[model samples]
Target: MYKKVALAIAFSPTIEALISETKRLVELFGSELILIHIGKKTDELETQLEEIIIKTGLDILNTKLIWKEGKPVHMILEACAEEKADLLIIGALKREGILTYYLGSVGRKLIRKSKCSILTLIDPRVEAERFSKVVVNGTQMEITPKVISKALKFCQIENVSQVHILNEIKLYAFRMATASKGSEDEVSNTRRKLIQDEIVYVQDILKDLDKTGLKINIKITAGKWAVELVRYCEAFKADLLILGDERGYTFIDRLFPHDLEDVLSELPCNLLIIK
Candidate 1:
């Protein structure tokens, strides 16, 4: 789905792993690779990058390298936009400080502000493994169908057999249904019906999707959507977690903590935010 894939380059230990992952994605999508570094470019730095590129087997001639001096976040985002990248790749930590979340780290800022889709790699390895088990957010939203469609297409390309579509029911709604003045049997029926409705909703979305050679599971979770999403991914040991992001956040959203904030605070795995 991605045409031009751009990576935020750093001289950290994870650079090789990040570049390796980017190489896989570039080859997979038949995309052009653009490596962006937000700092002064030096002969030493260029030599080191070339060595890594050769080691990673990324076609040096096909890759475009960019160097800019400015704020890291601004430079990276600007480069992505200038290059018209369809996807941006960055290495991410599993958790960030609360202050970073409130203020905004490079990763969090890009997640919120970048127009292109983002892939955050947690614990990236030089020997990258294929994503075999993926969990996609299937919560009823305007962008959910597109997100699921992208996820399925990615799974097909990667030959992933196990896929889970997770849908959520708000805890308040579930509580209201169960706390009604009804018999115990009635409460049980209400709970079952709610779960069934979620399943049906997800099934309807899947009806028009191409799910060939994939074993899909539909899961209904009740509670905070972000919390349940993280729990499900951890419980299933999902290799990647895909979700849709289209809402714009305001100051009030920051204060109240948006659902995406929860996911960004502590990533469950390699996260792909489809915008």
Candidate 2:
């Protein structure tokens, strides 16, 4: 269970929504909520923040309001470390459009860099109106189901709509017996065995999720793994991109270790990484 939840408030139009959603998360986990506001300092701004909190009827217990002056993402990160928050929640806003975009969002940045698990609410109303719909990539490991389940529970009280499981399969063709070539049959057999191993791994993960009520959609594709996964999400219109991190597994760090900050800067949608 989470011990503390940090809500990064930029005083945008979505602050109230962020607070409401943070309240839901706080009530769910029974965790402390730290409100972080970052921008140029002014005497009136702090007073205004307090007014907003009081007017919203937000509970003050286990809730903190911090005023900092600096870059939004940098200041938020500093506060997160200072508060030692277990999870960070932020709003994802669309740029000049009604639909939400994940790129260049403070939520996305914190999701990547914060050393704790991250939760993103697209908007308070959006979160209120519908449950989370997740799309996950990189299912070669055996521990994905457990991580996904925990994240789904954290996202909403209800189960997610569809969980997309994506795997990358790379195929290589061998040339005929030439000066630098080996036996075709031998190489083919080796490739087949490796492919079989990957298939078995995927099957094991699926079996672990057999009784889960969440809708499951599986895909095995061949290409640059990350690019393909991103494309798949765009094509399917997935709501959340649930990727794995260092939480439930031991060997994740050695295997394609992810930098959340870089991913947040690039992904077009919100990312939920199990750290």
Candidate 3:
């Protein structure tokens, strides 16, 4: 569960979803809410924010809305850090002609740069929204335990009934794609054993969370991780997706699945990325 949630607000169609999601979380965690909007403090913007506040029933005394002038990603990240926020929620700004709504420049930057967790809503106004079905990727070998523990705790608090751990087989296959294997049968056997081992590992990892009454599942799929992960989420109708940041935050330095550009671009559900 998050303690302090900072909302990165902007003047776009995405703002309403940001506000709505923020409101839900604020109520859920009773979190200290901080709204950061990066732009000139214009009277028009002030009136717009006022309307949002009224609609969301935000207690002005508790909610802090900061209007800053500068680069949006930098300011939002800075503000959240200064406020000691645990999670930062932002909407995915759709780029025209893109099959999926890719994170806007600011959002992409934040995911890469922000030290705290980020929740990106692909489309915010769902008829009914609950993170009942959640998926978390456990491919970052270094942080698998930390990520799983964090995700389990989140699921326990969010009342998530079903949770999935996505494990990828990217090592040998990527290398073998160019070279010939010893034999078809040998390769198949090796792959099957790998899958079984992965399941055992995931089951062991999830033992501590079993008492939480959460249904845990492990999926071992071939091909690029981003592609397999996104396909599983779409087929499963996952409500929220969680992944860790193993790479740097700059647009070029991130670990966004080199072959799966459309993973975020055409994502089928909301996403929560942690560093």
Candidate 4:
């Protein structure tokens, strides 16, 4: 049922693994694969890409190859919007340079701002997580029935049990009282406001999801959004983590770092990012 997917391949060592995983995903979901190669303009690389395609037997008609002369993240976002892709697949190479990868430098940029769901391949040797034991993370109220239905289909295919819903809400309190003065009332009021807002937000989301017949475990948490989400995945022994990515070009995303450190770094399980 997942028809359109945009795959951002670095054309590095992960290409072979990516192709193999693509085959598995297509077989499982019956979706179209748009393979994109991001690198400096070079005909040799293109030829190499083709050779790999032939070698891997990823010669399907639905597969596409794009050679763009720009930053990888920007070109990827453009492609997603143009193709109306439902998902984005990229490779995460874990190396010694952690700090450089952070601070909005490389692939992390796309991870933060991608409009469609993102599936990051952690190890070239490993592909595909459990079809069952899936975890869903997002605002419950915003999740559509169609999305839930699709998720259910995946669960059924994988024979999964226990879908955990993650709710993330943070609270902050402060006032500029000469940088030294603090008011107890101000702190108390801020706490009260945070609690009230969280209650309202969660209530609305829960009401909508209640309509779905799927049984799920509700997990309410506060603090950093992506970190806690990954933690829950680890604790529950979830095989897959599902998230919803918004579509289209987002100006704000480029300005900030992608907040999926735990999900990418501590990839104890596979990730399924859906739009």
Candidate 5:
């Protein structure tokens, strides 16, 4: 689905691993790779980047390298827009501290404001690893089908074996169902019915998808969406988690902490946020 993939390059310890992952994604998606570095252009830096590209098995001549001097977040987002990047890959910490939540980090800012889809690697390795288990947010939204489709496309390309689609039942709905003066058995039945309905909803979405060679598992979860999502991913030992950003997030939402914010604060796995 990604026609052009971009990597926000930083000469950090994970640079080699990041480049290797980016190269693999570009080759898999059949996309033009764009490397964006937010720093002054220097011959030494250029040479180093070239060496890394060659070492990572990416053709330096074929890759588009961009060097710009500006703020890291602004420059990276600008480059992604200018390059018309369908997907932007960047390295991210597995979990950010409390200070980062309020102050905002480069990775979080990019996730909040970037116009294109983003893939944040929590633990990038020099030797790229395969994504065998994938968990997709099957929340009931207009953008859910598109998110699932993109996830399935990636799974087909990567040959993922296990795919779990998680649909969450809102806590408020459950509260409302039990608010009525009902017996314990009635409340239990209400919860069971809610879970069944969510399963059917997810199945309907998957009915039109091409699930070839994939073991599809539909899970109906309850409680806070983001917290439950993280718990599910951890429990399932998912290598990748795909989520749909139907509506862009705002600063107020960040302060109050919404579903996306909760997930962003502590990534359970390599996150793929589809816009």
Candidate 6:
């Protein structure tokens, strides 16, 4: 559960869904909610936001509404940072174009830029569902522990019975680059040992989770990351997927402005990205 939640609101279809999900999360974590709207502040927009708050059933908590004038992405990120939000919830929609792998939508940008965790709902209409099973990626070995630690906090609150860990080593990149240093057999052994070592390391790091009494399974595969993850999650009916960002961003770019669009399409459930 998060301590503070920052919700970026725009006049879009995802607003209602975002608010609805926000209400559920607020109820779950008893967390403070900060509502941010970036646009020309107007009486009409205030009335609309008020109505939205009422509709969201946020009357139970003293929620704060902030109106600022600036670019949407800039204002949203600023508000989240100012509030020290542990969890930032936003929506993602595909843009109209040739559909490049890098879909630099505001949500994707926020996921990349924000230092905290983010929950992205690609579809506005999908209702907020309780998480029963969680799938967390461990490919970013350095950040895997933190990601799983946060996921375990949710599991403790949500009573998640199972967690699926995916550590996908990019075989395509490996064949081209990793083979440069070692013989065929050496490379094969190294690849096999990588997964074997990860299993032992992750299990050791997550020993505390075992006390929670949830069934945990970690598997390392060599293949396409996005394709295999989508296939595995769909088969298992994952309620939420958590991933970590490990790459260093060098610019005013919204988190990995290049690779996100290709990696994330529509998911069977929600996505939580921890930076």
Report each candidate's C-alpha RMSD, comma-separated, in the order given: 3.3, 5.1, 3.4, 6.4, 3.1, 4.5
* Ranked candidates, highest lDDT first: 1, 5, 3, 6, 2, 4
lDDT of 2 by residue, 1-275 (tens): 68888887776787766776677657767888799878775778777777766766667754688888887888888898999987887776665654435545555556656787776665465144344566776555555666655655544444567777676665442222222556877776765665566566656665654335666666777665667667787788766777766533566545443444444534645566666
Q: Model 4 compared with the native: what TM-score?
A: 0.66
Predictions in order: lDDT? 0.86, 0.65, 0.77, 0.64, 0.85, 0.73
Q: What RMSD does model 6 have? A: 4.5
lDDT of 6 by residue, 145-236 (tens): 87788777777777778888887765665576565777888888767766677677778768876437567788777765556676677788
Model 5: what TM-score?
0.92
Give the higher-TM-score candidate: 5 or 6: 5
Better of 3 and 5 by lDDT: 5
Q: After superposing candidate 3, which stretches have Cα over 4 Å from the reference?
A: 97-99, 126-128, 171-187, 248-262
Which has the better TM-score: candidate 1, or candidate 2?
1
Give the better candidate number (3 or 5) by TM-score.
Answer: 5
- Residues 38-72 of candidate 3 have per-residue lDDT tens digits of 98998988989888777767787788888888888
Instruction: Compute the lDDT of residue 198 as modeled in candidate 5.
Output: 91
Clashing pairs in 5: none
Candidate 1 lDDT tens digits, 1-275:
78999999899988999999889878988999999999999999999999999999999999999999999999899999999998999888533544221223888888888899999988778887788999999887777888999999989988997999999876677898888689989988888988998899889989998999999999998877788998899899888999888565334344324888788776778899888
State model 5's lDDT: 0.85
lDDT of 1 at 33: 94
TM-score list, all predictions: 0.92, 0.70, 0.86, 0.66, 0.92, 0.80
